[model samples]
Target: MFQNPSNEAIASILKNAKTIAVVGLSDDPSRESYAVSAEMQRRGYKIIPVNPNVQEVLGERAVASLADLPEPVDIVNIFRRSEALPDVVREAVNTSAPVIWAQQGIYNEEAADIARAHGKTMVMDRCIMVMHSLFVRGA
Candidate 1:
């Protein structure tokens, strides 16, 4: 059985995190990924878009992959489908980012295990924007 971290732990991560690499972030403003990432950006977190299909999103240049990031990020926020989590987690674990967060409706035990095994903080099936609003902004 897999469980998400406590609210306190989540708050801590949100508080300390300054940079987030949003995997699968779409260029289209209508997308959930774009909306969420935009909100996070408005809240002062640096948004790094990681989408091979787009050249840019929210004014930041999109990277083809996580490995393409010029610098280490604090969190690797994933917006990919549930079935793709394992592969994405595998890539995230290799990065310097300490946190691997899968957005709402995305969850995989294998992915969680891989992230945990790598000593990365794993957040599955949770909305980053909602969590930030709750834990950070106290909304």
Candidate 2:
């Protein structure tokens, strides 16, 4: 069984993070990924969209994968399916990002194990926007 870090720890992660690389972030505003990433952008975090399907999202150029990022990010926020988490986590672990955050309802034990093995902080099955509102923005 996997458990997310304490709320205080999550708050600390959010507080220290200035940039987020959002995997599977959709161009469509109606998509949860877009809405959440957009909100995070509006809240002062730089959002880098990672989606091969889209050229851009929320004014940031969309990269095909985490390996394509121009610079290191504070966090890697994933909105992909649960089955896809391990591969994404593997890629994220290779990056300089310290935190790997799987969006609400997305989780995989393999992914969690991989992240933990790499000494990365993994937040599984949680909403980054909601967490930001609760812990960062105090909403």
Candidate 3:
């Protein structure tokens, strides 16, 4: 379920991924998580907002954590601080998401290593929306 995506593989993931669970999602439209999730939703991907404080986002019910998601998630996009990486990685492992995407400016070598060790597709310090536009969506 998990494998490192080469440029071509990344292209494939973007082409086929149907759902994304966005951790650290915020109600504030200005937040990076919200913006990216909104973009992805507009692009036709289901964006599940994972956050404790928010009850809803983008008209969808918000999940408090990844583990609480009722269905399989193809990708887990994280917007948390780097210091929180380990716990997030553990959750990603538990959730069995095929891809774990650490948003732009968010990176932790230890977490990336753990994710890779678990055979997860890990994309650190990158923006999925940007990558999708550049490599697949042709924005």
Which sections of candidate 1 miss by over 4 Å?
A: none
Which portions of model 3 show Cα errors greater than 4 Å?
A: 1-4
In candidate 2, which residue ranges exceed 4 Å CA deviation? none
Clashes of 3: 0
TM-score of each: 0.98, 0.98, 0.93
Q: Which lDDT value does model 2 have at 8?
A: 97
For model 3, what is the alpha-carbon lDDT of residue 136? 88
The global Cα lDDT (0 to 1) of model 3 is: 0.87
lDDT, candidate 3, 19-129, per-residue tens: 899999999998888888999999999988999999999988999998899789899999999889878988998885888988888888888888888888888778999
> In every candidate, how many clashes are there?
0, 0, 0
- RMSD in order of candidates: 0.8, 0.9, 2.7
